[model samples]
Target: TVDKYGDNSIKLGITNMLIGEYLHTIDNKKRLAVPAKLRDKIGKKAVITRGLDNCLFLYPLKEWEALAEKLSKLPVGQGDTRSFIRLMLAGASEVEMDSLGRILIPDYLKNYAELKKDIVIAGLYNRLEIWDKEKWSLYKENAGRNSEEIAEKLGELGVY
Candidate 1:
């Protein structure tokens, strides 16, 4: 249920807390420099996991703890909740940024998200999502494709 908030939360996190975008290059080895703005808030130690979208998820330890705390109270009988918990917790990896503020993204995750030479790091509330640049472009274009339908739906909810 923790992840069940409307997609608006996703947009709000990215635009409000994240506030800006950092387009950076990923090395051949999948190493990336954490944006200075984000690094200042996240510190050297962080956690990485599978994101809801097709992107690698990054979180500060404190943020992960908050999420974990919220998830702990969910009913265990719900299959979807269990699956989300398993995927999020099992995929999480604790990592430390190197002296140069770089973190090594796991190969499996990189391959899962198709992250390679170029990447985009954006803030999303308590966490961050890393996206392959080209994939991000395509995703952005498609995300806007149904804007009118989305607006109409939001209007029904008194959000527009």
Candidate 2:
């Protein structure tokens, strides 16, 4: 299923190509400006939620809706599915961009990601991931060092 936005960007189900990475800072009020290049693609409103690896995920409304649909279809009898759904949905917050294109990160979400002043907003195809700058640096370093191994693992899944 493809959904077209006013700007003509097409979202094909869970596939939205969000590219580029940006460095930003959280203000005293916990607001961070969305990168200008990404502002339109992410839309005026989005859903923020806890993400893997101690980061936060920002999903455009349409993408979030698709993801929520998938999550809703997870087997209800499975404990792991229930837990994962709770973790993702319970922490979700609907946020709208301010006039300056900034979105306020809730305190709980901030604490969950351990976000301080320095932050990194990274484009991850379908979602934008917000991470503490220092943590992002560390993660990049570690991932870089293990890229070969990671690629090998992914190759098994036909991703290589």
Candidate 3:
């Protein structure tokens, strides 16, 4: 299991964790059954928030706390960072899986991410990202188009 406690101490903990992609439907009432493999690492409780790719991000409690700290550091008077913090925080929700590993996503968040029935859940290092299927497909296409250019830019930043 990933070290939940260690995740608490650092604002961002790193873990390879279980990585896969799965598609499931959000029920009429906005309930989703988390994949079993992810459940084992995150346990029953999780914090969900907005992510950069117009998708939902799920983090363990400790990981969420770490993120909260970083967001808190953003100046309220600033433009971009403040807006980011507000949007991300406003979309955040805390949820726990039932015995069957089902989580009830609030309607507001569902609407924010334009999520309907089908959702794609993917493991991304320390956290998980959920996307509406069609939206995710579009995102992948966009990313693919920019992949080479983006890599070149990263290399210029000494990221290579």
Candidate 4:
């Protein structure tokens, strides 16, 4: 968008992508306080669901709806596609952030991600990935080791 000064700037209507990693703790009640920075992008009402790589994915309401719509369009005749649809759509839960910017995670999701007291919330563009602290560390380390190879693959796909 261009402001009165004729310079480009981001406005509310533009997509607000998420990007960052934060360390946090889950309370005994399984309440996770999302980092205020990330929380601002996701808003209050969000959707939590099983994610790839043994983590939980949290999406903003609008992003979730868009994803759900896309998921609904996939061909159900393929076994893998059907399984993926079930894994994502069926396992999704609508969650609301409380007054303290905390979202109470369901036991099923908590167990799926194996979330313990210490947790890592990684903001990846449109979604937030909730992972166990140890797992994140390991994943980050492994990914860091293979970043060059990963970048090559992305380059081949024209992602860079």
The lDDT ranking, best first, is 2, 4, 3, 1
Question: Could you estimate the TM-score for every candidate?
Answer: 0.80, 0.90, 0.84, 0.90
What lDDT score is found at residue 55 in candidate 4? 97
lDDT on C-alpha atoms for all candidate structures: 0.78, 0.89, 0.81, 0.88
Worst ten-residue run, lDDT, model 2? 1-10
Number of colliding residue pairs in each model: 0, 0, 0, 0
lDDT of 3 by residue, 17-107 (tens): 7478899989887889989767766667788888877788888777688888999987788798888997778878889888888888887
RMSD of 4: 5.6
Residues 18-122, candidate 1, lDDT per residue (tens digit)?
A: 445679998877789998766756667888888877888888776788888888888879999999988788888888888889999888788878887889887
Backbone clashes in model 3, listed as residue pairs: none
Q: Candidate 1 — which pairs collide?
A: none
Candidate 4 lDDT tens digits, 1-160: 5332221323354346677889999999999998986666777788999999999999987778899999999999999999999999999998888889999999999999999999999988889999999999999999999999999999999996
